[model samples]
Target: MRWDGVHIAATGVWLPGRLSAEEAVAAGAYDADEHAANRIVSVAAAETEADGGPSAPEMAVRAARTALRRAGAAAERVSAVFHSHVWFQGADMWTPASYVADRTAGSGVPAFGLQQSCNAGVSSLELGARHLEVGGAVLLTTADRFSGPSFDRWRCERGLVYGDAGTALVLSSVGGFARLLSTSTAVDNSLEAISRPASPVADPSEARRPLDLSALADDYVRANGDPRRLTLRTAQVADASVRQALADADTRMEDVSRVVLNATGRSRMRWQLELQLGLNEKMSNWEFCSEAGHLGAGDHFAGLDDLVRSGQVLPGDRVLLVGGGTGYSCTSAVVEITESAHRPE
Candidate 1:
């Protein structure tokens, strides 16, 4: 949908640290061949909370604080807070969004949490843009910590490596750094089974089993026939979503200065988006993403932060952010930088 009054006021990202792929291989936590195939050099890994490190919510708060400061928005100025995540955030049956709101944007801001897999960040941005009124501001945050006993970041997925990080974006109706031109989403519900648990939902034991995305995808492909056909369809849908977003923004593909895509893998990135959209690797944030791994829903947000901080995105530059979630959902957004922010050191 086209947006008239929405702007990306500021963005912030908080990464714990990086764990090299070589280190993972040396520790027998990852396969060297697979790491070479994925072409991911490193991944952001969070330190244990026992080391005085921040938890998921705490990380989100840190990012939010930075974003709010950059936007020059006080806690009371924020109208809402939306937190997105891919895994558990410390506690069970608890609301991390409320905690984030209380710490950053203050109370009674209608804070809430959402899970649309990796698409949650962009999805929340879309929702927040639509919810914003004149002069109102919305705080969007995404965070995830993929540790042991629940998830093995390096080996959980086939061609993708998960990372631990928190990202925040302050969206406001008041003018700011970049204008949110448009956002679009497309879904293929039939592909949802590709990530579904092997066991029944009634059994929670299935959740404890080390996540095997490769096995799940293989089973789904075998049952559905032709894996190549499924891949083609995904690429087509993603292309269509991006095209629609560009159209809504009244821009052409060639007009985009940068593209932020999911940090899946080099091969998948080439086949899925770059090839389908006729974009070169230079137009995408592959170098930064390769080091960070997939920051769940925060990939696009973090990419935006990198682009702005590195001064690759300047005033009047148009940027495309695309994301695909495990629930077989795809989303795209077009952003136009209206003002250049100070580059980070």
Candidate 2:
């Protein structure tokens, strides 16, 4: 849908220490052949508080403060706070969004957490833009630490390496760095079983052991049909979402200067986005994503922040943010930078 006055006031990101893929291979934590195939060099991994690292919510607070400061927005000025995550956020059934809001944006803001898999960041932007009124501001944050006995960041899922990081975007009706033009989302429920466990259960312990995604995928294919059909449908939906977003923004694919895509493997990136959209590999943030891995719902936010901070995006340039989540949902957003980021703060 088209947006009228919503703009991105500022963005902030916090990435923890990184672990090289080669180091994982050397330590027998990852397979050499798979690493070569994925073409990922390193992934951001979180450290304990004893090592001076922050928890997921703490990182969100840090990033939110930076974004709010850059936007010159006081805690009282924030009307809402939306935090997204994909893993256990150091607590069970606790309100991390409230923690973030109380610590950064104040106590009375309408703060809540969302779980849309990896698409939550972009989805939050879309939702926040719709919620904003004249002169209102919304704080959107995403953070995840993919560690522990339940998940292996390096081997839990195929074709993607999970990362630990926090990202924030202060969006406001008041003008700032970039204008949000349009956003769109699409979903295919048939593919939902791909991420669902093979057997349904009332308790967590009743679920399959190890939570093997590969096994779940195999079961989905066997129960449904060939997996290629699913891939084709997913690519079609993703391409359609991008086209619709651009159309709503009154722009075209050729007008987009940058495309921030999901931090998946090289093959998936090539097939799902670049090749499908006829876009050059250089137009996407693949090189940076290779080093940072997939930061759960924060990939697009972190990627956009990198583009602005590195001077790759300029005033009047158009950018396309696109990604999908395990719910078989795809989303895309079109943004136009309104001011040169090179100007002194």
lDDT of 2: 0.86
How does candidate 1 fare on TM-score?
0.96
> Backbone clash tally for model 1?
0
Q: Summarize candidate 2's per-residue lDDT along 1-345 as a digit string, tens digits.
A: 999999999998989878999999999998887798899999999896667778888888888887888887433468999999988788887999999999988987889898889989998988898878646899999998877567788887788888999999999987779999999998887778888866678987676655567778878889888788977888888878888999999998899999998898777677656578888888898988999999999999999988998889999899999978878888899999988765444
TM-scores, one per candidate: 0.96, 0.95
Each prediction's total of clashing residue pairs, residues at least 3 apart in sequence or on different chains, is: 0, 0
The digit string of per-residue lDDT tens for model 1 on 1-345 reads 999988898898999889998889999999887888888989999887887777888889989988888887433478899999998899988999999999988877889899899988988878998778546899999998888767889888888899999999999987789999999998887778888755547756646467678878888888889998988877777877888999999999999999999888787777655568888888988899789999999999999999998889899999999988877888999999988886653
Clash count, predicted structure 2: 0
**What is the Cα-based lDDT of residue 182 in candidate 2?**
95
Instruction: Give the residue spans of candidate 1 off by over 4 A.
Output: 74-76, 206-208
lDDT, residue 58, model 2: 88
